[model samples]
Target: MMNDEVIKLIENRRSIRSFEERPLDPEVLDKLKRLTLRCPTGGRFSVIEIVDQSKKDKLCALCENQVMISRAPGVWLFLSDMERFYSWMKEKKCAENFGESLNKPGIGTFHLGMQDAIIAAQNAVIAAEAMGMHSCFVGDIIENYEEIQAMFNLPKYAVPACLLIFGYAKSIPTSPLTSRPEPEYVFMKDGYKHQSVDECEKMYEKNTVSFRERGVLPFDNTGSYIEWYYRKKYTSDWMAEMSRSVGVFLDRWLSDEA
Candidate 1:
C-alpha cells in the first residue's frame, strides 16, 4: 500500500517549463543528487550538471530554442555510459571476450542503458518536486548528437540519454489535470494484443477532444484526431530531423566496424 503523501506527490506532478530566475540552493541540489544516486541502474550512468551560461545558451539553441532550458537554474544531462566499465575492464586485464562484449553495444544494451538513465532522471525529478522545485524533461537532447558529443568530449560508448531542467516555477499550476487513457488500453493481462482501428480511436478520444478544444489542429476538417496528430507530429520536419540524428548516433556510437 502507498502512503497518502506519496500518492499526492504523484498526482500533483506536472511538467513545469516556466521557472523563476533565482538559482537553487546548494543544499537542495546536493539532496537531489543523493536521491538520484539511489535510483537503480543496469550497470552505471553519468550525470552532468550545466551551470555555465554559455553552455546553457548553446543547449537552448541546440534544443529547438526552448528558452525554458536557459531560464532554469539547474540543468542535468544524463548519459548512458559504458566507457567507465570498459576502462575498468582494461585496468583489470579482463578477458578479450569480456571487453569485446560491449565494444559495440547492440539494441538490447542500448535499451538497458537508456532505461537506467531514465530511471535516474525520474528520481531527480521527483526529488526536485519534493523540495518544492519543478522540472521538465527535454527529449530534444537526441538532436545535434555530434555537437553534444564534441561539446562533452564523450567517449565512443557514452551517449546522451536525456536532459532535465529544474528550478522554482514562476507560478503555481492553475490548469486542470491532464487526462490519460484507461489502463485497459495499454496494460495487457497476458500476451500482447493488437488493438483494432476503432478500438484505438475510442481509447484516444479523450486526448483528441482535449486537443480539439485547445485548437491545436491546423484545420477543423483534418480527418480524425489521430490523423491530425500524426500529420502534426509524425510527419513534421523536426521529427524527420530527430530520426536522422538517431540514425547517425547509432552509427557513430554502436558501429561494430568502429
Candidate 2:
C-alpha cells in the first residue's frame, strides 16, 4: 500500500515550522514506527523514541530555545546509538552488536546507526507527508547538546543526530518549491566532479532571476541575499560549536569500534 503512495507524497511534502496543539493518531504512529524499522540501515543501531509531552517540553529548550517546536504533533530525536548496541552485544554475545571489529570498512556500528537513524527520519517525513502532515527538521537541537542529551540522560556513545517535528496544517502557505541547482549540475555521472566558478555564477544568476520573478525585493547582489539568510540562520554561535562537538562525539562513538 505504501509503495504506491510515494508518488503523491514526494510532490506535496513541505517543511512546516508552526503547529497546533493536536496529537497524531496512535495507529498512524504505530505504522510510522513499523515502516521506519523497514528502512535499510548501515549496521546495528538502537531505537530511542520520545513521545511524551514531558520530553517534548525540553526539546523546545534543546532547539536553541525555539518557541514553536514542542507544539508539533509528532517529533523525533534520532541518535547514533553506540551505547545501546554495546549493551545489545553483551546480551546477545555478538561482535556485530558492539560493532564490527577493526577489520570493517567503516566505524562499524556507529556509522550504521547514523545511517539507520537518517533513513528512519527521512521515512518519517515521507509517511507524514502522505498523511497530509507538515514537518520541519530541527538542526538546531545540537546547539545545547550537553543539556539536551542530559535531559534524556543519554549514555556514552549515544548522541543526538537530528530531529524532525511534524504537525497537522491549519493553512498551507503558497510557498514556492525552493530553487535548487539543475540535477545535472549537482549530480555527477561518476566520481566527485564539481561545478566550475562560471557554472556556479550562472546558477546564481538563474536563482536571482527566479527570485526577482517571485517579487522578493531589492534585486541586489546574490551575496547580500545569501548573507541575509546566513544571518537569520546562523545567527547563533552555537551552530559552529555544535559541529565541533559532534565531531568529537562521533570520534568517540567510532573509537571503540575502530
The number of clashing residue pairs in each candidate reads 0, 1
lDDT of 1 by residue, 1-258 (tens): 768887799889999999999888898888999988888867657888999999999999999999998888989999887778767876776756565442444566666778898899999988888888889999889888888888888777778899999899998789987777889999987889999999998998887787878777656754567888789778987788788887887787667654
Candidate 1 clash pair list: none
Query: Candidate 2 regions off by >4 Å?
Result: 1-5, 92-108, 204-236, 254-258
| Local accuracy of candidate 2 as per-residue lDDT tens digits, 1-258 | 565567766866777778766777898888777766777776445555667877777778766777567677777888877666566655676766567542322366666677777787887787777667777887876666667767888776677777888778766779676666777777787698887767766766656566556555243543434444455446647767677667766665556542
- The CA lDDT at 74 in model 2 is 77
TM-score of each: 0.92, 0.79
For candidate 2, the TM-score is 0.79
Model 2: lowest-lDDT 10 consecutive positions: 217-226
- CA lDDT of each candidate? 0.84, 0.69
